[model samples]
Structure formats: structure tokens, C-alpha cells
Target: MKITFLGTGTSQGVPVIACPCRVCKSDSAKDKRLRSSVLVQLKKSNIVIDAGPDFRYQMLREDVKLLDAILITHSHKDHIAGLDDVRSYNYLQKRPMDIYASVRDQETIKQEFSYAFREYLYPGVPVINLHNIQQGIRINGADIEVLPVLHMKMEVYGYKIGDFAYITDANFIPAETMAKLMDCKVIVLNALRKEPHVSHYNLEEAVRVLEFLRPEKAYLTHISHLMGFHEEVEKELPGFIRLAYDGLELDIPNSWSE
Candidate 1:
């Protein structure tokens, strides 16, 4: 399976509007980030995790022609705002996009995009089928396991597919979720900055969790301009862990050879 970091920045993204931070002004391309999101390409299906405000551009930049589903982590606007653009896929695929989210999040989606849920929908509206996430839910042949964690007080979901796991917009990961992540070969976690954050993990905390999970490889995402330049921050992490940037891609075997 292949994984792509569609966007790695926090809600406002890198180069935050009207901010003259050094990290944002850096010349490196890695410093330019969009909102947090990822694309997972499996043997028979392609799925996207989160559809933030940058969704359209991310999809166009990647030239994604086929998409099977979208897995939402929570109801936060940064995670679900660009869902309206799924209409492009609906037009091309000639079917309703299948979206998986928690029951509470589904309600929020309906509220946010009430036009799509109307009995008599207007033309050209995004067509989507909402599925409440549950055990044994599979997209095509890929089995997805939901990892529930906490974004401050709100419940958020991380996901495990095969030997790859992804978690973002989280500060507290429950013990049960940690157990589910133990065997993952590759893991992605959020690290907003060097300082402590109330709803997101800081660099130190993210490193500690990755160290405990001990995945063969770990990546930090959902970064902020405050995290410092990508090249420098990366050097501070363990060799097994790296900071993920927009457009970063990874290929993982279905199972470890060992």
C-alpha cells in the first residue's frame, strides 16, 4: 500500500495569514504546507483521510483520478470544510462518495452541508453516502480499524490499515488505542510545535509516544509555523522518525518480511 501526505500543517496551515515568522518565510518548499490530510492508496481502492480547506488543490496536485472513500477523524472544520468539493469526484465517478465518520460527526456534516442532505437537492451538489464507522468495515478489500483518541475533550478517531497507522489532531491517545497501534510497521502522529498545546501534541510528546509504540518508521504531521524549519526540526528526531511534509509519500509492504 502507498501513503501520501496530502497536507501536513495545522488548521491555519503554514505561513499563517499575515504572520511574518521565519519558518513561514523560509525558502524551502517543505515550509509551504496546507491543512492536514492524507491519501492512502491500496491495491483495489484509494482513500483520503480528512478533507480540509485545501482538498481541491491537493487532489488536483496529486492528479487523483479515482477515490473510493473518505475517513473523517472528527467534526472540526479544518478536517471537514472542503468536503463540499467531493462533488467533482461524484461527477467523474458517477456515484455518491462514501464517507465514514462517527455518528456525532455525521450529524455535524449534515448540519454543515445541509444542502446536500435535502430531500430535493439542487443540481451540482456534492453527492455523498454517510456510513457510521463500525467494526469490520472494509473499503473494497482493505480492512480498516478505528483508533479512538482524544483531541482535548472531543473524541477523535485515528485509523489502522494493515501495518500502517495514522493519527492527527490529537493530544491524548487512550491506552486501548495505544494497544491497537503496537504492531503497526509505520505510524503517523501529529506534532503541532515545540511547546505544549491543549488539543495537539507538541514535538516532545509526539516523540515520546512514537518511542513507546516503536514502529519501524514514524512520521510527524499537522505541524505549525511555530515548529521551526522542516530541515532543522527533522534533525532533532530519532532516525526512525521524520517530519512529514506536503506531498511526502511512502510505500509499505502488506506484511513485514521478518
Candidate 2:
């Protein structure tokens, strides 16, 4: 499977409105990040993890032709706002895109895009098949399994597919969920910034999680400008862990090989 990092930045992204921080001002392309999102391609499957604000550009830049499904982490605006953009894929593929999310998150989508739920309310609003995911229920066709997590008290989900796991917007994963991710060969997770934050994992805490989970390789994403230079922060990480940048691709072998 080829996993692509569509966007590596946090909610505000690297360049906040008019902050003009050095990381934002830097000419290096890696420093310029969109919101958190990823595209995973395996065999004929083209699944996206999170549909952030940059959904259009990510697809166009990658020349994505068709998308089979979308797996949402939570109902946060940054994660689900670009959901309407799936219309392009729906038109190209001539089928409805299956969206998998928790029941609460599905509610958020219905409320946010009321017209999409009703056929007569608006035309061309995008047709989507909603699958409400209950924790620990494995979807057979998908190589991935949904691992529910906690962002503080709120329930969020991270996905484990084959030997690759992608976890974003999660502050903590309980002992059981952590065990599930241990099966991953390459782990992609959110590491907000250098300092601690209430709702997200800071760099130090993220490192601890990495150590315990012990994936062969770990890449930090959902970064904020406060994380500092990409190169500089990366240098501080252990050899097995690196910072993920947009368009970064990694090939993780199936766990059967391990």
C-alpha cells in the first residue's frame, strides 16, 4: 500500500492568518502545510482519512482520479468541513462515496450539511452513504480497523490498516487501543507542538506514546507553527521517528511479513 500525507499541519495550519512566524515565512516547501489529512491507496482501494479544508488542492495536486471512501476521525470543522468536495469523486466514479464515522459525528454532518441529507432540498449537493462505526467492529473489505481514542473526554477514532496506522487529533489512547496499534509497522500520529496542550499530544507526550507503542517507524503530523522549523524539530526526534510533511509517501509491508 502507498500512504500519502495529504496535509500535515494542525487546525490553524503552519501559517496562521498574519502571524508571520519564521516557520511560516520560510521558503522551504515542507514548512507550508495544510490541515491534517491523508490518502491511502491499496490495490484498487482509494480511501482518504479526514477531509480537511485543503481537500480540493490535495486531490488536484496528486491527480487523484477516484475515491472509494472517507474515514472521519471526529466531527471537528477542520476534519469534516471539506466533505462536500467529495462530489467531484462521486461524479467521476458514478457512485456514492461511503463515509464512515461515529454516530455523534454523523449527526454533526447531517446538521452541518442539512441539504445533503435531503434529496429534494438541494441538487448536486453530493451523494454519500453513511456507515456508523461502533468501536471494535471490523469491516471485512477494509484492511484497516477503526481504533477509538479519546481527545480529552471526547471520543475520537484513529485507524489501523495493515501495518500502517494513522491517528490524528487524539490526546491519548487507552491501554487497549494502544495495544491494537502495536501491530503497526509505520505509525502516523498528531504531535501538536513543543509545549503541552490540554486537548492534543505535545511533542514530549507524543514521544512517550511512540516509545510505548514501538512502531518500527513513526511520523509526527498535525503540527502547529509553535513546533518550530521542520528540520530543527525533526533533529530532536529519535532515529525511528520523523516529522511528516505534505506529499510524503511511505510503503509499509503487510503485517504477515513481520
Candidate 3:
């Protein structure tokens, strides 16, 4: 299986407006990040996690022509705003793509993409078949499961798609969720910055999760400019846990046994 990091920036994305930080102005392409999202491909089937505002740009950059499904973690705009861009795939396949999310998020989608849900609207608008998933639904043919997590006070979600698990926009993962993610070979978590925020898991908190979860490897995403230079913050992390940047690709096994 191969996974691609589409975007790694936090809600505001990297290079915060008007702030002339060195990392923001750096020439290295690694410093640039769009909103956090990922694409997973298993042979012919393709799955995308979160369709933030940069979804269009991410698709264009990767030249993606088809996708089997889209999994949403929450209703946050940065995570679901770009959902409309899936029309390109719908247009090409002449079919609606399967969309999986919690019931709460489904309501959010109805409000956010009311045009797409108009029933008898534009034939060209993207059409999605909603599949409301709760805590432990298997992903179609996959043995993997979804684990709901608490992002501080509000509830966001994390997905365990076999051996690879992704949890972004989360500050806390309760014991139950942690238990579900125990054996993951690769774990991706959000690390917004060095300093603690009210909602997000800062770099330190992410590190703590890495330590507590003890996955084979951990990758950090959903970053903010507050996290500082990619290389710099990465240097401080343990070898088992690395920071993820846009366009990063990794090949891993399916722990959930396909």
C-alpha cells in the first residue's frame, strides 16, 4: 500500500499571512504545506482522508483522475471544504463517489455542500453516496476500523485503516481509542505547534502520544507555522516519530489483513 501526504499545514496553512518568519520565507519546498490531508492507494482502489480547501490543488498537483472513496474526520472547514472538488472524479467515472463520515459530519456536509445535495440540480455537479460510519465500521472490503477520538472538548475522529492510522486535529485520544490503535505500524497525528493550544495537540503532546501509543512509526501532520521550520522541529523528535510534509509518500503493510 502507498500513502501520499497531500497537505501538512494546520487550518490556516503554512506561511501565515504577514508574518515574516524565516521558515516561512525559506527557499526549501519542504517548508511549504497546504491544509492537512492524505491520499491512500491500494492497487486499483484509492481512498482520500479529509478534503480540505487545498483538495483541488492537491488533486491537480498529483494528477489524480479517480478515487474510490473519501473519509472525513470531522466537519471543520479546513478538513471538509474541498469536498466539492471530487466532481472531477465523478465527471470522469460518471458515478457518485462513496463518502464516509459520522452522522454529525453528514449534517455538516449537507449544509456546506447544499448544492451537491439539491437532488435535481446540475448534472455536472459532483454526486456522493453518503455512508454514515460510526466508531467501528469496516472500510468496505478492508478489515480496518474507525476509532472515534476526542479533540479536547469537541469530538473529532481518527481512522485506523489497517496497520496505518491517521488522527489529525486532535488534542486527546482517550484510552479506548488508544487501545484500538495499539498495533498500528504507522500512526499519523496532528501537531499544531510548540506551544499548547486550546484545541490542537502541540508538538509536545504529539510526542507524548507517540510515546504512549508506541506504534512502529509515527508521523506528524496538521501543522501550523507556529511549529517552526520542518527540519528544525523534526530534529528534536525521536527517530521512530517523524514529521510529515506535503507530497511525502510511504509504502506500508495492511495490519487489518485486507
Candidate 4:
């Protein structure tokens, strides 16, 4: 399986509009980030996680010709805003896009894209099939485990597929969710910045969680300009953990034996 980091920045993204911070102005490509999202490719399926506002460009940049499903983490705009663009795939594939989300999130989607659900639909509105997340849900033969964590008081889902796990926009991870992630070989988590955040883990807190989980390799995502330049911040992290960047890809074996 292969995983591509579609975008690794926070809600506002790196180089936040009109800001003059050094990390924002850095020349390195790693410093330029879009809102956090990822594409997971399996032998027979392509899945995307969290199609934020940058989803269209992220898909186009990756030249993704086929998409099987989308798993939403939460209803936050940065995570769901670009869902309307799925109409492109609806047109090409001649089928409604399958979207998996919690019951609460499904309501948000209905409200945000009300036209799609109207009795009389527009010619080009995105056609979506909303599926409520449930236990033992499989997509194209891949087993997905949902890990629920806390983004402050709100619940956000992190997904575990094969031996890889991804969690973002979370500040507190419940013990049950931590248990689910304990066996993952590679884990991705959000680290908003260097300081404390009420709703997201800061760099130091993120490191602590990773250390406890002790994955073979870990990545930090949903970064902010305050995280400092990628190169500089990288030097401070444990060798096994690195900050994720847009367009980065990873190949994972079905098992560690590979």
C-alpha cells in the first residue's frame, strides 16, 4: 500500500495569508503546506482522508484519476469544504462518490451541500452517497478501524488501516484509541505548533504521545508557521519522527516482515 500526504498544514495552512513569519517566507518547498489530508492507495482501491478546501488542487496535483471513497474525520470546514468538488469524479465515474462519516458529520454534509440532497437536483451538483461509520466496515477489501479522540470537547476520528494510523485535529486521545494505535507500524498525528493549544497537540505534547505509542516510525502533520522552518524543526525531533509535507509519499508493507 502507498500513502501520500496531500496537505500537511493546519486549518489556515502554512504561509497564512499576508503573514511575514520566517517559516511562511522560507524558500524551502517543505515550508509551503496546504490543509492536512492524505491519499491511501491499495491494490484495487484509492481512498482519501479529509478532503479539505485544498482537495481539488491536491487531487489535480497528484493527478488522481480514480477515487473510490472518502473518510471524513470531522465536520470542520478545513476538512470538508472541498467536498463539493467531488462532482468531477461523479461525472467521470458515472457514480455517486461514497463518503463515510459519523452520523453527526453526515448532517453537516447534508446542510453544507443541501442542493445535492434536494428532490430536484441541479445538473452538476456533486452526487454523494453518505454512509454512517460502523464497526467492521471494509472498503474494497481493506479493514478500517476507527479511533476516536478529542479535539477539545468535540470528537474526531482517527483511522487505522493495515499497520498505518492517521490522527489529526486532536488534543486528547482516549485510552481505547491509544490501544488501537499501539500496533501500528507507522503513525501520523497532528502537532499544531511549538506552544500549547487548547484543541490541538503542540510539538512537545505530540512528541510525548508518540513516545508513549512507540511506533516504528511516526509523522507530524497539521503544522503551523509557528513550528519554525521544517529543516530547523526536523533537527529537533527524534530521528524516527519527522514532520510531514505536502506530496510526500510512503510505501508500507502488509506486515513488518516485508
Candidate 5:
């Protein structure tokens, strides 16, 4: 399995407009992020987790020609805003994009993109098939396990595919959910900044979770401008943990491969 970090920044993205922070002013490419998202490329299909506001640009930047499905982590605008842009893929693939989300997020999708659900759809509207996630689901020949975590009072989803797990926009991970992540070789968790956040994990909390999970490798994502320079934060992390930047790629053995 191959994973690509499509966007590693938080909802507002890096270099928040008009904010004069040193990390924002830095010229390094690693300092630039475009909201949080990931592209998982499997042998039979390509899946994108979250389609943030930068989804279009992310797709264009990566020159993606075929996308089989999208797995939504929550109803947050940053994670689902770019969903409308799937029209481009619809045009090219000549098929409705398969989208998996919780029932709550499905409601948000309907409310936010009401036009798409209209009986008499307008031309050029994104074509999508919404599937409400239960415990887990299969798509494009891959089975994905959905793990529920808490984002403040709201429930959010994290996903486990093969030996990889990804969680974002979360602050509290229940013990049940943590159990699902035990065997994951690689895990990605959101770390909004250095300080505590009501709806997201701070750097320290994220590291603590990583330490407990003891994954072979753990990456921090969904970063904010306040997270400091990527290089600086990276230097402070343990050997098993690293800061994930946009466009970072990792290749892992596909257990399903024969």
C-alpha cells in the first residue's frame, strides 16, 4: 500500500492569512500545508481520505487520473468542503464518486450540498453515491475499518486499512477505538499545535498517544500555523514519531497482495 499526504495543515491551512508568524514567513516547502487529507493507492483502487478546501489543487498537483472512492472523517467543512470539486473526476471517470461517511456526516453533506441531492439535478453537479458507514465497509476491493473517536463532544471517525490507521480532528480517543489501532504498523494522528485544544490534540497529547500505541512509525498531521516550523517541531520528536508534511509519501507492504 502506498500513502501520500495530500495536505497536512489544519482547517485554516498553514500561513494563515495576515498572520505574521515565523513559521508562516519561512520559505521552506515543508512549512506550507493545504488542510488535512491523504491519498491511499492500493493495487486495485485509489482512495482519498477527506476532501478539504484544497482538494482540487491537491488532485491537480498530484496529477491524479483515477479516484475510486472517498472516505470522510467527519462533517467538518475543512474535511468535506472540496467534495463538490469531485465533479472533475465524475467527468473523467464517467461514474458517480463513491463516498463513505457516518450518518451524521451524510446529513451534513445533504445540508451543505443540497443542490446535489435535488431530484432534478442541474448539469455539472458532482455525482456521488453516499454510503453511511456502520462498523466497517468495503470499497474497490479494499476493506476499511472505521474507528470512532471524539472531537470535543462530537463523534468523529478514524480509519484503519491493512496495517495503517489515520485519525484527524480528534481530541479524545476512547479505549475501544484505541484497541482497533493496536496492530497498525503506521498511524497518523492530528496535532493542532503546541497548546491544548478543546477539539484537537496538542503535540504532547498526540505523542503520548503514539507512545502508548507503539506503532513502528507515527506521523502527526492536521497542523496549524502555531505548531511552529515543521523542521523545528520534527527535531523535537522521538525517533518513532515524525511530523507529516504535504506530499510526504510512504510505501508499506500490502498484506492482501499475493
Candidate 6:
């Protein structure tokens, strides 16, 4: 399995409009981020988690040619805003994009992109097949497990595929959900900043979760400008943990257990 970090920034993304924070102004490429998202390429599957506002550019930058499915983590604009761009794939593949999401997020998608769902829609509208994910789903020979977590007051879902798990936009994870993460070889969690926040995990809180989970490799994503420079913050992380940047890729062996 090959995992790609498409984007790693918070909702507004790095270099927020009209803002002049040091981290935002940094010249390093690592500091420049799009919204948070990732693409998971399995043996015979290509799936993306979270479309976000930068979906179009992320795909273009990566020169992606095939996308089998998309998994939505939540209904937030930063996560689903760019879903409309899937029309490009619809045109190229001649098939409806398979979209997996909770019922609540499906409602949000319907409201946000009513034109696409209209019975008599335009020919160019994005074509999508919505699948409500309650327990788990199977696609292209891979089984996915949905782990529920909390994003402030709203409930969100994290996904576990083989030995890799991804959880973002989450502030609190229930004990049961934490248990679901057991045996994961790699985990990607949100770490917004050093200071605590109401709707997202701070660096310390994320680190604590990593310590408890004890994944062989842990990456922090969904970063904010307040998180400080990537290099500086990375120096403070444990040896096995690293800051994920756009375009970062990791190759995982077929074995789910190490």
C-alpha cells in the first residue's frame, strides 16, 4: 500500500488570506500547505480521504489518473468543499464517483451541492454514487473499518485500512474508538498547534494519544499557522513521530502486522 499526503493544513490552510504570521510567511515548502487530505493507493484500489478545498489542485499537482472512491471524514467545508471537482473524473472515467460518508454528511453534501442531485441536472454536473457507511465497507478487495470520534460537539469518523489509520478534524476520541485503533502500524492524527483549542487537538494532546496508541510510525497533520514552523515543531516531536507535508508518501508492506 502506498499513502500520499495531499494536504496537511487546517481549514483556512497555510498562508491564510491577508494574514502575516511567521509560519505562514516562511519560505520553506513544508510551511506551504493546502487543506488536509490524503490519497491511499492499495494493491488494486485508489481511495481518497477528505476532498477539502484544495482537491482540484492536489489532484493536478499529483497528476492523479485513477480514483476508485472517496471517503469523507466529516461535513465541514474544509473537508467536503471540493467534492464538486470530482466531475473531472466523471468525465474521464465515464462512471459515477463512489462517495462514502455518514448519513449526516450525505445530507450536508446534498444541501451544499443541490444542483448535482437535481433529477434533471446539467450534463456536466458531477456524477456520484453515495454510500452510507454505518459499520464498514469493502472495495477492490480491501476491508475498511470506520472508527467514530468527536469533532467538538459533532461526531466524525476516522478510517482504518489494513495497518494504517487516519483521524483528522477530531478533538476527542472515545475510549472505544481508541481501542479500535489498536494494532495500527501507522497513524495520522490532527495536531493543530502547541496551545490547546476547543475543536482540535493541540500538539501535546495529539502526542499523548500517540504515546497511548504506540503505532510504529505517527504523523501529525491538519496544522495551523500557530503551530510554528514545521522544522522547529518537528524537532520537539518523538523520534518515531514526524510532521506530514504535502506530497509525502509512505510505502507499507502487505503485512498488516509488524
Instruction: State the C-alpha lDDT per candidate.
Output: 0.94, 0.87, 0.86, 0.94, 0.94, 0.93
Worst 10 contiguous positions by lDDT, candidate 5: 249-258
Residue-level lDDT tens digits of model 5 in 1-258:
999999999989998988888988999999999999999999988999999899999999988899999999998999999999999989989999999999989999999999999999999999989998895878766889999999999999999999999999999999999999998999999999999999999999999999999999999999999999998899999999999999999998877751
List per-candidate RMSD values in Å: 1.8, 2.0, 1.5, 1.6, 0.9, 1.6
User: What is candidate 5's local distance difference test score?
Assistant: 0.94
* Candidate 3 ranges beyond 4 A from true positions: 138-140, 256-258
Residue-level lDDT of model 3, residues 1-258, one tens digit each, is 789999999988887667789877877788899999999887547889999999999999988878888888998999999988888888888889788888889998988899889958886777988887764555546644777777778788788776888999888888888898888889999998899898898999889888988888899999888788888887899999999999999999754444
Query: How would you encode candidate 2's per-residue C-alpha lDDT over 1-258 as one tens digit per residue?
Result: 788999999998878789878988888888989999999887757889999888888999989897888999999988998999999988888888889999999999999978889858566887888887775333335556888888989989999888888999989898888888877789988999989999899999999999988888999999999999998988899999999998899886655321
Which runs of model 4 end up more than 4 angstroms from their true locations? 256-258
**How many steric overlaps does candidate 6 have?**
0
> Over the full model, what C-alpha lDDT does candidate 4 score relative to the true structure?
0.94
- Ten residues in a row with the worst lDDT in model 1? 249-258
Clashing pairs in 2: none
Which whole-number lDDT from 0 to 100 does residue 163 have in model 3?
Answer: 84
Comparing 3 with 6 on lDDT, the higher-scoring candidate is 6
- Report the candidate with higher lDDT, 2 versus 6: 6
Q: Which stretches of candidate 6 lie over 4 Å from their true place?
A: 256-258
lDDT of 6 at 5: 99
Tens digit of per-residue lDDT, candidate 4, span 1-258: 899999999999989999988888899999999999999998878999999999999999999999999999999999999999999999999999999999999999999989999999979999999997867458877788898999999999999888999999999999999989889999999999998999999999999999999999999999999999999999999988999999999999975221
Model 2 scores worst on lDDT over the 10 consecutive residues at: 135-144
